[model samples]
Target: MKFKFVALVATAVAAQFVAPVASANDQLAQSICAYVADNNKNNLRKTLSDNRLRLKAVYDGISCDGLPLVRFAIKNNAADTAEFIIKQLPGSQVAQSGDIEWANSNGFAASPILEVIKARSAS
Candidate 1:
């Protein structure tokens, strides 16, 4: 009975520590989404820098309204953010992610960001 109580207490303590970390991550993601939506590149960069996060490192983990970062930017007509994100990503990743194809299929082919993606992929 004592052992079980100790285990339960330990579990509760562990959960208290874990919950804040998860919430922090959620808050960070929300901030990123908001920044992207607003096309506020400076704030976005500041947030990532403050968190010691490289955009490329966290890119795959983030989705804005269920769309990947670049796609989300395109959807929101955040051209500056979209181009910035595309340029930060590796050319191979940009090409292999099929963003160009997705954009064409989704009627985003006219977006100038597509040109940026193509250029980045070529380089």
Candidate 2:
């Protein structure tokens, strides 16, 4: 939780620089990332749906903490949101597994997000 807070703050800080240098793709990514960070499920879904043709950009835009949108959904307890993203981006299962390694190395191995990732991958 503390890490999530810190990540959000860092995202806010980084957003300042990111806004100026961001290309159209980066801007789109940033917007989606912001929605995920804020747990704005409705906006995120709309944004994602609107940019369905730009799936690569959506996948590239990670949260301020470098977390994928699915992890954000897990942290926010937004199971439906997570499910939607998981279905939309099946390749993220590999990324989620990588996050588990990162969490273990970074001392957050007990995170519920990891459990959710594990459960999803098991299915």
lDDT (Cα, tens digit) per residue for candidate 2, span 1-123: 999999999999999877776676677777876776666767877886786654445464466456766655555555555555655655555455476676577676666666666665666
Clashes of each: 0, 0
TM-score of 2: 0.55
Assess each prediction's global lDDT (C-alpha) against the native: 0.90, 0.64
Inter-residue clash pairs, candidate 1 = none
Clashes of 1: 0
Tell me, what's the RMSD of every candidate? 0.9, 13.6
Candidate 1: tens digits of C-alpha lDDT, residues 7-54: 999999999999999999999999999999998888998999899999
Instruction: Name the runs in model 2 displaced over 4 angstroms.
Output: 1-22, 54-84
For this target, which candidate reaches the highest lDDT against the unseen true structure?
1
Off by over 4 Å in 1: none
